[model samples]
Target: MEGKDTDQIPLLIPYKLGQIRLSHRIVLAPLTRFRSYNSIPQSHAILYYSQRTTKGGFLIAEAACISRAAQGFKNTPGIWSKEHIDAWKPIVDAVHAKGGIFFCQLWHPGRVSDQSFEPNVGQAPVSSSDKQCSPLVDGGVEFKFLTPRKLNSDEIRPIVDDYRMAARNAIEAGFDGVEIHGAHGYLIDQFLKDQVNDRTDDYGGSLENRCRFALEVVETIANEIGPDKVGIRLSPFSNYMDAGDSNPEALGIYLAKSLNKYGILYCHVVEPRMEVMEERTECVVSLGPMRRAFNGTFIAAGGYEREDGNNAITEGRADLVAYGRLFLANPDLPRRFELDAELNKHNRDTFYSPDPVVGYTDYPFLETII
Candidate 1:
């Protein structure tokens, strides 16, 4: 995929995070395509992710639900079924064949969900408390309120077990590791945010208590499949889904410290966003505090381009960088960086639709004439 101008581009470098040695610092972040609307991913879904694999790069698979009740957006994939695991096997195997590492990002969307997308027999999304999410109905429908069921002390144990089962499924599917989706104002982030979590139990009041569920899930996943094969993603202070923790600094520090104790692979954080007209402006937050808290590797995502990714590594703020939409538009993203090639613009219309081969995996890699 290298271009004629590749010689002018800075030399791409290799880096190491714990036991995982990356040939390049670039990583493909989890971007939700929603093409796999059904609970099970099809063979085409396998081809989509497999096509993006490059030598020693990392692929964090799009958010796969931990359970049926956790399904949120239409067409999103899940790991709750045997068919799901079977469907993903070829994708992970293909990445391995290319000498790349793949991680299935496990998630539960929680109250950020609609009843229309609920699983066949599951209840409305469950969260740390019974709270209604800011309704932004996906398909141009009139917005409706979602009163999610709250998990009690007894009920919490099973959901935690679901995470463990999902982790086991990831390994069975041939993934190198598993990434817990604790970011983007989803289930785990809902638990961390005081505005969403209002219960009086240990999982509600203080910052430590608010992070209890996340800690439990991380610890459980690490225990299930060695800490080296587990990682967690978090959006500390962003309101991507109307989520904000009472004390972001404290929450970040505490969670980072707890994760370090597990000796997991890394912690991926989404940088803060500022609204600018119709679009949002992304800025890098100081990673100094979090770097101190987590002794393991750290990755930064959200609006990071090649130069920014390089800068983040140069500044010692991040060990690696994750690209979401950029990777969507440019499948050979690392090569694009290596050659300083102009990227293909993403078609926003096809981002979430169910049509196959449109936005799913149509991006062609750049080829050069020797």
Candidate 2:
């Protein structure tokens, strides 16, 4: 196949977000590979990440649970212990050795967790309210979610502290920075959305009150690690894992404006495709408004092809574009995009398997395939 002219692709251009400079606008979105065994990153992770690293490329690690109670999936890594920190050090080093920038995504699953996956099996998951939801787990089994116990007013601070310490852990583990996983129906998103957060305390009732928990977590983590080194991911229109908002556009704009106060490194937003699961009058809620509201760098993710991502960046819809499946199948994704090369098809079946290699690091580079 003939290569596309490099001048036509805006994705190959370098960009800077605060102190972090990236060689290209293509970012490797955080993907849950589930290769970590016993909640610790293993040797396979180093190869899995380094293979995708391009010089000065920006890669966000898959969400690392902030605490044991925050864990929701099997084999997902954690950053809450000394061993977890020690384990991540080499993985971070490998990316750095390739001249890449890495960010650890700190996460908490909240009420979206199953009893079988909890530290205390049979323990009910905790959330802002007692609403229960049954979500599909691995192997297509529908796991019945328990009615979560409402977090006591005093209990909220400890969760914030958990995020603060996790930020510290990421820095110690040699990560360039940290991205707070406030999106995708996780703990922070659970609190931000009104459909799930039914409470009369300071953490609920008004929009400002509802945003309190998310703000606190961001503030605490930013203080722990410099605000310039911190970023956040938000899915205002997402109903996945049962997180939906009455007014996503308004919520997104409010968050964008609020986040501007801290001068964070970037704010990552999921594109409209992921929000389609929930019925909406508008097929695609534009990120343009949110982009204009925020002062810092903005990243757009979900359902973006090379041309779409380049258009989004060139049109000023986002400062960067994150790709998930494309990067997963093409270890040399940046070069492939630059050349308009054929992308390897990703096998969905092997996405979360515990195999050390196979689909994980076995994807051949362009040169190897040639």
Candidate 3:
């Protein structure tokens, strides 16, 4: 889709975002490609990320599991160990060398995890409640999730501490900042959604209580690495991993209002149209109200075409637009958007393949084809 001709296209404009100044409003969204093996980032990751880096561009790295217990997917990277930190250092440095700002996304899968992928084999996943959902299978049919063990009150603090330590590890690995992956039915999302969080303790039940786990993790990460360097990703209406909120609109506004006090760098929200891990619902809540609630920079993602992204930024709905699949297929996506060039379609088959470079760093630049 072509962007409308205008004197100023908001997507191409430079903006100052927190401590980092962005050259354009296009952000590379965090995507799980399942390329890392044994929870360690590989050499191809450096090439993949650097290929997408543009001067002053913002790139949020794929969600890195905060601890061994937090892992859910196969071959996904983590930020828990010193070895992991060392592995990520070169990737971060490569992006920085190209003048791109990189943020490591801190993640925990909670009840969404599979026993085979868990650090302790044969152990069930942990979550706010003892509910079960389907575990992700590569090129296979979905399977039922093992009933997760409910996190005890004493165990909650340690999980929060894991996020704090992960934030420190991200900084030590040369990341410009850390983004708390509180969205899309992950560990944090499990706590935020009432459908999943059935606990009567202080960490569940009421909206404030349900949101406590998310808040604590964010606050701890923000405190560990200055709030100016912290950002969060949220998906209120997302039904992913069986995480559907009773009142998505109210939940979104409340979370935004609460996050306002933290002075975080940005709030990255998934647009209502895209379905992450579940079937699309008929009910769609507009992100307009939530955008207004948060005073910081707002990033909108999911199913955005060139024109749609430009319009969202031009209409004042979002300060920036994040592209996932489009960026994956087009390494120089920002330049393509600038010149209104044709976008290479992403190959769905190789998206999560374990291949080192088939879909990782093989996408050609516009100049190469020209």
Kindly report which residue stretches of model 3 are placed more than 4 angstroms away from their true locations once superposed: 1-7, 135-144, 276-284
Return model 3's CA RMSD, one decimal. Answer: 2.6
TM-scores for every candidate against the unseen true structure = 0.92, 0.95, 0.95
lDDT of the candidates, in the order given? 0.79, 0.86, 0.88
Writing each residue's lDDT as its tens digit, candidate 1 over 22-82 gives: 7777888898777775767767776677778888888899899888777776678899878
The residue-level lDDT of candidate 1 at 158 comes to: 91
Q: What's model 2's lDDT at 341?
A: 81
* Candidate 2 overall lDDT versus native: 0.86
Tell me the spans in candidate 1 whose CA falls farther than 4 Å from its real position.
1-11, 120-122, 137-145, 274-278, 282-285, 368-370
State the lDDT of candidate 2 residue by residue for 40-140, as single tens digits: 99988999999999888999999999998888777899999999999999999999999999999999988887655666576777898888765655423
Residue-level lDDT for 103 in candidate 1:
93
State which candidate has the highest lDDT.
Answer: 3
State the lDDT at 117 in candidate 1: 62
